[model samples]
Target: MSENNKFKDFFKFGDFGNYFVRVFQKPDPNQKSNYNLRMMHGINKISIVVFLLAIIFWIVKRFI
Candidate 1:
């Protein structure tokens, strides 16, 4: 598959439900290391943190 196709497939497969599954899946020692996986995990963590912070800020704004 071409690089562009692979990029599209990533989104198709990595939709929200699959994302959480991927995030919680156990690491395999035998599998070759993948840069994409690490990058996705980092993005997931950052997204979750940012979302939580936004919610907190919204709540505080409502109270004040």
Candidate 2:
């Protein structure tokens, strides 16, 4: 196999190697106290809320 094929095979599993996969991964308890992790969690929560609000707005706008 070529170098490209080897790299492809490493992540061939569906969604297994996707960029967002890591975002859904469980946080390590050991790192829970880290400031960076706390900040990341806050960001993730805000982003999710914003995304949901955007979807709701789009639906309402579409119907009305």
Candidate 3:
């Protein structure tokens, strides 16, 4: 099999993009509200932010 066909099995970019938007955007109005799910998303957003910040700090510390 070609490399393109092999990579196709890894992930679809559209699904990844949709997940990022779903995590950050307001929940749909028609959907039922769930406090636990909301809190989980909130925690996820915080962790992603922290991870990115740590990466940036590490890069800067390495260069300077």
The residue-by-residue lDDT of candidate 2 on 1-64, one tens digit each, is 8999999988687764453556666766776367887788678767877998999999999999
Q: Against the true structure, what is each candidate's TM-score?
A: 0.52, 0.51, 0.70
Between candidates 1 and 2, the lDDT winner: 1
The 10 consecutive residues of candidate 3 with the worst lDDT sum are 9-18
Better of 2 and 3 by TM-score: 3
lDDT of 2: 0.76
Task: Give the number of the best model, judged by lDDT.
Answer: 3
Cα lDDT, model 1, residue 21: 72
- lDDT to native, each model: 0.81, 0.76, 0.88
lDDT of 3 by residue, 1-64 (tens): 8899879866667887688768989888999989999999999999988998999999999999
lDDT of 2 at 64: 100
Query: Tens digits of per-residue lDDT for model 1 on 1-64?
Result: 8999998877685477576676756778898879998888888878977887999999999999
Please give the ranking of all candidate structures by lDDT, highest first, separated by commas: 3, 1, 2
lDDT value, residue 61 of candidate 3:
100
Positional deviation of 14 in candidate 2, in angstroms?
A: 14
